[model samples]
Target: MAPNFSDLVEEARLSLQALVDYGDQLFNPTVRLGVTGLSRAGKTVFITALIHGLLRGGRFPVFEAFATGRIARARLAPQPDDAVPRFAYESHVRTLVEERQWPHSTVDISELRLVIDYQRPNGADRTLTLDIVDYPGEWLLDLPLLAKSYQEWSAESLKLSRQGPRLPLAAAWHAHLATLDPRGRADEQETLTAAGLFTDYLRACRDERFAMSLLPPGRFLMPGGLAGSPALTFAPLDVPADGSAPDGSLWAMMARRYEAYKDVVVRPFFRDHFARLDRQIVLVDALAAFNAGPEALHDLQAALAGILDCFRVGRRTFFASLLRPRIDRILFAATKADHLHHASHDRLEAILKRMVDRAVTQAAFAGAEVDVVALAAVRATREVRMRRGHEQLPSIVGTPLAGEVANGEAFDGSTEVATFPGDLPTQPDGLFSVPADSGSFKGLSHFKGLSHGSADQADYRFLRFRPPQLDNDGGDTPYLPHIRLDRALQFLIGDRLT
Candidate 1:
């Protein structure tokens, strides 16, 4: 019999491994970054901009030596390691260049890898491989819950259904499930029926997309066709009452599925990928929360608390080859600072600091450090002079949608429009009662506004993220020119010292 294709491929791998081992031993550090945020948080734009800034080795005010701070050098060349995944850089680049438009919202988890070469402060040259993973912001919330049993998780979900803001869909699903007799024989029909209603609620979430940040199976929802997959069909855990056994009940079956989900989906992702992170960058859209209703505001706080629990470093395993959880620094960046003016950027940063102050304080026991910053990935609008005497001010010269009116004229979408304030702060103590303004939302309009902007250019769009920062002794201080990647690098991984 002829040698099979699989056999040929296995033979090739052996041959390649032998040749590749001949090179000088190269050290590889897998820095897994989790770019997390609420629904509209500007993760895609921030990542895209970070990649662009790193690639462009020139003077950048928001980046350290790119302009002044430190005398340094930079360059971007083809990455060597085939295992390092490639970011959709070319496609994203084309979205701006070819389409002359913002790219569609990042709907699922996409991985990108790049090798950035630079000379350290000690004059030694090195190549740092960055393995970047971008996933839907909402899925991050599900990470912590993976450790819980289905009964425990289901009970919590049931509790949350009655209390959390705007969880009508989840509430209705639970109400329908209550009608079924849990103690009866496994009625596949009734179970499937209840599951169908719950699935509908999940589907509704996908359809609106921007309404609430509480997304279900976030990665799966974006593609829509994955609903049939077993991984996406998990039911919330339902704990038994009377302190008695409910094994062999419908709830038990669903609980089993939930366990499978945690074992098959969540554990591997964390142990193999997430548990080894060296750095984290959490993107926050403080302004967006202030603009949303009280319910959203409350939900945001609960969501943050849940996500931060993961960073509190648990026990370390010897056999895993994992680095002891040394991720000491965490940067909570308030993205889309360009939407406001320079004066208000600090205020925006301050607001974020205030909002997450409790979260940081709680996680401090794990050696995690925290900082808040206001940033813009792409500086779409520039502040120009309103009068002859003053200096140029930040302004945008684009259409609202192709044909929308602003200050009259034919609205050619070419005239420069002023962008005031600067950065936006987190909601102040009394922001809820601040009274409605023209831009404030009354009902569902808030969700509409969130879905309507680009990274830096959008009139009203911000992103939230929570990726681990690179851990190093010197990676604690905040970076100067806080908007760019070089600044992020200084704060997240500056031990290289060059």
Candidate 2:
């Protein structure tokens, strides 16, 4: 198909922006790093810990520029984008360090600028401006909608709503959907009711029990300011995938709003924020998916693929950078490594690696460097060996959040306990296989019980732990402990620092 006038205009704008960005980079080098993840995937914590580590000189043995005494200073600078909100670094640090609590998750897009003064390997001094863009992963999933028509999206969404765990959760929406007539005249109250039910269904699917990752129309889950607006008030109709909407029909109203959503929400994000990224880190809650079973895992896999497809990923040449910049490096880090014992950490990484294997291959083939790591940006637990029966089991010791229950005992938030976090499958392939009915609803239950050295355990239940108490002796800055965060940093912006 030939490009439309709008497409041409969009391309021109992108080129103009890229040209300006390229010109700026020639004098003052910058790396626009994007950090995002699904709801409760620890994006805020990751960014907070990353900035704190760099500024306060936290322990990072593998981050060569920081560890080798080459980095003279790293400090916050004014972000270039005046319209965007600054990331609340000071407030979040206070929450984590002083209050000993996790900060609120990223609700909308925010930017933070870090300027690093360092000595190059050749002993020359240089500065690098690092602009970190933080947004929701749900927004990333919506990018693919640009290529899809309302009919196609409706058909796909309806099909997905009828399958597996979603089938039960979507019952109310489907019930209302059955009564709607796409060919009839559009009814205001009916449309409103349908939209409400659909939004409720999306919210239900997002429940930690279901852990459904592929739910799009991303704003429904995190509408921000778009709530109750016509743009977010459209629900998928049971219409023919190849059919066009009749003028002034129910289908026409929905189709129009869908287009509006794309124009108003998704497009600006892609053009202004996503397209400008030089590197990105997508955090995943693979453990949540694992507890939810194979269906959730598969859903998460599909979601990851969709997220990667949105990136204009490839190596950037000088001329290419002038017209269109590409994200040359991508990192997919599985968050919440502190929830598991050290022995299962590699296994967790393996599961994530398997999930993104196909996406990684495609990104690499397109000249993007992609890597995966299991990381806890703010480590909340410590490892220990506990005696259970005649043998010792690898256990993680941490304070379970208030009301968190394990083996019929509910924690009171202050009491610390040692529990054996179950082992992951030795090979991640088994996890991708069709699961039997036994472990499918593991996430719905309170706890799966501590595994007594069961190699065959498929349901790995994890308790949410409170942030560890940071020890500040003699007024020294307390370090936020992490797992493999340095490895993640190495793959993302290591070459630029060098």
Candidate 3:
């Protein structure tokens, strides 16, 4: 068997891109670092904090290059690709540093370039360019489609929809699917209605209440202006387990559109941005999965496994680029450490490791240097000791997001409060799920009837806090506070700077 012409063209493009990258890096040491995570995983905040840390020389003790004073300076540079939107660093940082508020999450792909001047151990001065590509982790969830046919995807999706937590949310979509005849001719309005219902189902699954993580066809949730287009209008059709779609039929129409989605949306993303990475970091809101209970935790684990499978996991070397790009290092960072007390940070990391164990193992088996960290790009809360009847407890103090309730009291977004964000188990085994006897749906009983303050009562649940206030020091000396972002930096790009 031989690769078809289309496959040949794709390979040529990949090789050419790699060659261009290699040639460019010979003169300018550049690392294409990719940052992405599922929605609300803090991709935007992570990028903002990372750039602010580098440019402002933020206080990061663990990042070797910065800590050892080997780095002269880091400055923003024009990104190499003009076609891609520049990450709005200035605006986002302002809201975070000045206004003391979080910025909006990422909706599409954006890039930033930071040029760092450093002194090598031998005292020779060198410069390295870091190109950071930030995109929605939702899109990364679609990579599995690269190897799946529409039928396979449909079957998998339908089967998943019928599962414990998803079954209820997928009710309408399943009903709509049932009404449509796969063998009949495709109708425009009917197709639109089905797609709309399917997208709605995905939205429900991704709601903060649910915190589910495995929704695919990423564009369905955040269309990015692709709404109503044919490529985004297809829904999975009901089909027999082993049957082919007939030409000019409803199933065929959906099949064409599904393939079109892969060709038009998924393939180009991999070819243009994904495959070019030298290092990658996947930020995870592991606590959310914990709060969502066992079913969501297992779903997240499955999602992570699928997403990690798409990586060309291996060490990046000169030879790797000559053939194709390889991501040498991959870091899975559990974001939002500030929400909990420092005492449990390691436990959080351990719990996240268990959450992503299979994915990390797969990447490690391929010789990729994989690491995990509990990080907060911005530490929104300060730790304090609160006494409850003579017993001192470690707690975090910050201004909660407006309307955040505690003990039936609502925060005004300006009043500071100290609350004990509960702790994780020293052993990671008992964290993601409750006992089966407690309730059904894979231990969702752990979060039974959780809402507002009651939900926050869950040991793993944490409240959202506003960004911390910064001192009078202006832009030139911006030093944002963070938790272990330096360690993350040390793992991802410390060697490149050296």
Candidate 4:
């Protein structure tokens, strides 16, 4: 079959953009860096802290360019896309640094461009644009939808919903599905009601307690400005395996809207935002998965795998990627290392590596460089030693966020206290094991149990701490405290400077 004209036109447009980018690079060098993570993964903090650190010329022994004084200065410039919202860096940083409160989560895709001026060995000054793009991880989960038809998505979603932890939450949505007849004529009210129920089910599964990572139609959770639009109003149906939707039928209506979502919501994002990246960072809230138990852990792994598939991880020419951009380097980071003691930081990185092992393998095999790091973009706590009876316990001292509880005691957000966070397993696979009785989700049986203390127990005492106060010089910006951020910078853009 011959290719469609619209497909050809899109290919040509993308290729032209790539050629333009290539031509611009002749005089102006730039790197598009993508920042994303699941809800509460601290994407905002990472970006804010990274910028603050560079602008302040912070002490970073690992980031060679900055540490060695080769990089003269880093400053923000006008972002490339005027249509896209600029990342609220100043506001977010002030809240995190001065007010000691966490910033708001990202609901829509935003952009920020940083121009770094560095001194060269040849006595010349050089500069490059670091374009940071931020978006919700929920949206990334929808990448898989491109490869699936409406019927396929419905069947798979139903299967996933029927499993552990999700079954109870999906009760209402399931009830609504049971009442609907796919072959019946499409009714506007019925369509809206089903979408509402299904959306509710997705939200319920993502409650803080569960922290599920596999939810799709990502707009359902962080709809941005698309809330209530027909593009966001479709839900899966129980269409028979071989069923065909007659025009004006409920199934037909849903299928049509699903296609529109892919065209309007998914494709544009993939082309304009995601696919163009030169390097990327995927932040993971690993601690949340531990708290949510084994099922959530498995879901996170699957989500990462699905997301990995979306990245074109390989060595490709600019022309090749103008058609389909290939990410040259990708970093998967375990965020919120401050939630645990310093000793567990390595363990956290190891566990994150295990979680994305398969995806990492795929990326590396395709010739892309990949790394995993455990970091707190903004260090929110300090290590303390507490003498308890005969044992000196390692603890973290920080102000707990208001209403945050420890041992049934609530914090006022201003009182500082030391609390002993529980230990993580010495080995990584402990979190991947699935017990014999958990014959629930597919491919999950291959998981090994996450032994909280031993090889047999499962637990993680994940806690929330308020952002720490900085002894600032009263400048417009100050260096934000962080863990392993220098190493992350080295991996992300070190080569570009060299």
- Note each model's CA RMSD in angstroms: 10.6, 2.9, 2.9, 3.7
lDDT to native, each model? 0.52, 0.87, 0.84, 0.84
lDDT of 1 by residue, 413-443 (tens): 3444443332333344443343332234333
Best by TM-score: 2
Q: Could you tell me which 10 consecutive residues in candidate 2 have the lowest summed lDDT?
A: 440-449
Q: Residues 49-120, candidate 4, lDDT per residue (tens digit)?
A: 888888877667899888888998899998789889999998997898778899999889999999999987
On residues 289-399, what C-alpha lDDT tens digit does candidate 3 reach at each position? 766666767777777787788899897778878888888899999999998889889988987888778788888998899999999999988998877666676778888
Model 2, TM vs. native: 0.95
Candidate 1 Cα deviation (angstroms), residue 421: 6.3
Task: Report the Cα lDDT for candidate 1.
Answer: 0.52
RMSD, candidate 3, Å:
2.9
Each prediction's TM-score versus the true structure:
0.71, 0.95, 0.94, 0.93
By summed lDDT, the worst window of 10 consecutive residues in model 4 runs over 447-456
Q: How many backbone clashes does candidate 2 have?
A: 0
TM-score of 4: 0.93
Deviation in Å, model 3, residue 335 alpha carbon: 0.5
What TM-score does model 1 achieve against the real structure?
0.71
TM-score-better candidate, 3 vs 4: 3
lDDT by residue (12-52, candidate 2, tens digit) is 89989999898899999999999998988999999999999
Which residue pairs collide, candidate 3? Answer: none
